[model samples]
Target: MDSFKHMHEWRQNIDRFFGESFWNEFDSILKPNIPQINIYRKDYEILCVINIPGIQQIKQIRCEIDGYHLRLQGEIELPAKGYELIQEEIIQGSFNRAIELPYRCREDKVHARYEHGLVFVKLYKDVHDSNKSKTISIEEGEQ
Candidate 1:
């Protein structure tokens, strides 16, 4: 029938408008999230496992803690040089990622290690005195 032929043509036109090349261009424009991380909470400490490949040295990564947040900054470099890139799926660039912790961590008790292209960070929780109270002094001020 003519109606079925027209429907097929419409579908083909729509598919040609948004084809594989369009999606490939879109993927190139949007960068994927690099250095994926996983966090685990234990009784007294938090463990963070981060995937950071293509790092040549441990000094390429830096970790910092602020309040209840952990910040990781690093650069990933490809081990091979002087080679043409035919296809690229792994991302290689400088990245900064921040992770929110469940509780405040002690700055002095934190430790991190890099092995087998993965960084393991251990953060010890800070003990707080919940029952401690402070007396407030009231002062009169102008309106």
Candidate 2:
């Protein structure tokens, strides 16, 4: 049909204009490329739990919170002498994950703990009032 051909041509033109990036982003958002996260909502706070295995050391991971987004960037080094794997599905290499957090966290109260090869970060809901105020002790003639 001529109408079907016109629709196909229009679709191709749109795709050509946007390139593959538009589709890729749409795919990423439609079906996120990361592991699933579980949200536990209590009366006062929202908790996000991610199952990140094989990640050790809280210091090795970098966490940054900006507005509603929280990002975690880190590396998990594989063992040097693991037997030649025929089939490997475990995800390796450095991963950078950006998660949109449901609630604001206290920037100073964000804490991380590692146990059983999993890294867990607890973000508190309330920002500490003390963190907002900066005390500058001006020493006489120190400048």
Candidate 3:
């Protein structure tokens, strides 16, 4: 009987230390990675396929290209109103994902489309003279 009392006290201590919000934090950490992406590079274009479920409209996602990087920002929402949640494994929230490209992409030639819970982004490579040099201006700091 004494050992049972000690075990109960230990469980209470652990519960107090973890609190009620611990599962929320744990769920965020343990949930699957959102907006999983796959990139493919061809000779002059790059194709990026992203998995983003629960998007209601295409306007909910924003895609951008910066130099050799592709940025995706969006929110995924699941309609769960007036219903009890027995279990929650799907992640639904705002996400911002940045992916590095193998080469610089042209900003003006970028194309993006969303379909069937997936986002497809196609970017054209920026073909420029890499050997060209430009002058840099330097400003003196406190010496």
* Candidate 1: tens digits of C-alpha lDDT, residues 25-135: 554368766677899999999998888887766667877776577888888788778899889877788998778889887776666777777778878887852322221
lDDT of 3 by residue, 19-75 (tens): 856657666467756778899988898988888888766667777777777777889
Please, what is the whole-model Cα lDDT of each candidate in the order they appear? 0.73, 0.57, 0.72
Q: Model 2: residues >4 Å from true position, as ranges? A: 1-18, 25-36, 80-82, 126-143
TM-score of 2: 0.59
Q: Single out the weakest 10-residue window by summed lDDT for candidate 2.
A: 134-143
Clashing pairs in 3: none
Q: Per-residue lDDT tens digits of candidate 2, residues 7-54?
A: 988878888999846667676666554433566667545555555555
Report each candidate's C-alpha RMSD, comma-separated, in the order given: 14.9, 11.2, 13.3
In order, how many clashes per candidate?
0, 0, 0
For model 3, the stretches where C-alpha displacement exceeds 4 angstroms are 1-32, 129-143
Question: How far off is residue 47 in model 2, in Å?
Answer: 2.5
Quote each prediction's TM-score: 0.64, 0.59, 0.63
Q: How far is 105's C-alpha from truth in model 1 (Å)?
A: 1.3
| Candidate 2 residue pairs that clash | none
